[model samples]
Target: MSFLLTSCSTYPVEVTSADQLAGVWEDFAGRTVEFKGDGTFTATGMDEADVGEECSGVAATQQGALSLSGTYADVTFDGVDCEGMMLAFYGSPSSFVVCFTRDVTAGGCTGELSRKDDVTATGRHE
Candidate 1:
């Protein structure tokens, strides 16, 4: 005689929201990033972070639009500044991926932007 057994595992995945990305996010290199509901974004930095920072184009997203598009000019990063465009899809409010052209100085930086996670918003860093 023989017996069979079955097992399964489950994990929880966090969902993203447009509101989560509405605030400003800064990188380790002191860069301020803000995403607006109108499919617009603004980034400010100094030196390396501001090598080619410029907002050239604009876009819009409706209530049901799942993707966002925009253009940029003289954006800089990683010691390289170039002009290019960026297309980002809605992931979670905390995380997102920006696909851009070669106009910016830096390549692509992927990370999370969370105001709640960073206590600095409340003047506390711990």
Candidate 2:
């Protein structure tokens, strides 16, 4: 005789409002994204000398706006800003992520939204 066991984990916390998104998130390249409560955001810690299609870090330095669409938020830059920038939070409010994709139609773009550390927020960093 044998027994079978299974385990499940809670899905990452979905960002629903600007209040939930208001905080600082640092990417793998040491770039930081500061999301403000007033539908405004600022990103820093990127060098203009190194920018390209593959490197989305440049978007971090550009001023952008956020509009929540369901559980995901779309980030559009000003002027000729970064194309296809999206924001999503997982695991917890402390876990922030950003993705660069025009759309995830078909089977969905996997492994794009990476986890980032939440540096600060108004009062929702727990």
Top candidate on lDDT is 2
Tens-place lDDT digits, model 1, residues 1-126: 111111110111132444434666554344455655543456554232122235322211111112222222222222222334333222322343332233223433333222434535443322
Q: What is the C-alpha lDDT of each candidate?
A: 0.33, 0.49
Clashes of each: 12, 1
- True-vs-predicted CA distance for residue 61, candidate 1, Å: 22
Clashes of 1: 12
lDDT of 2 by residue, 3-117 (tens): 1111111233456778776676554445656778888877675433322364355544467788887545776666545655665433434443444344433212223223244
117: Cα error in model 1, Å: 3.6
In candidate 2, list every pair of residues with a backbone clash.
12-91
Candidate 1's TM-score:
0.34
Question: How big is the positional error of residue 126 in model 2, measured in Å on the Cα after superposition?
Answer: 12
Best by TM-score: 2
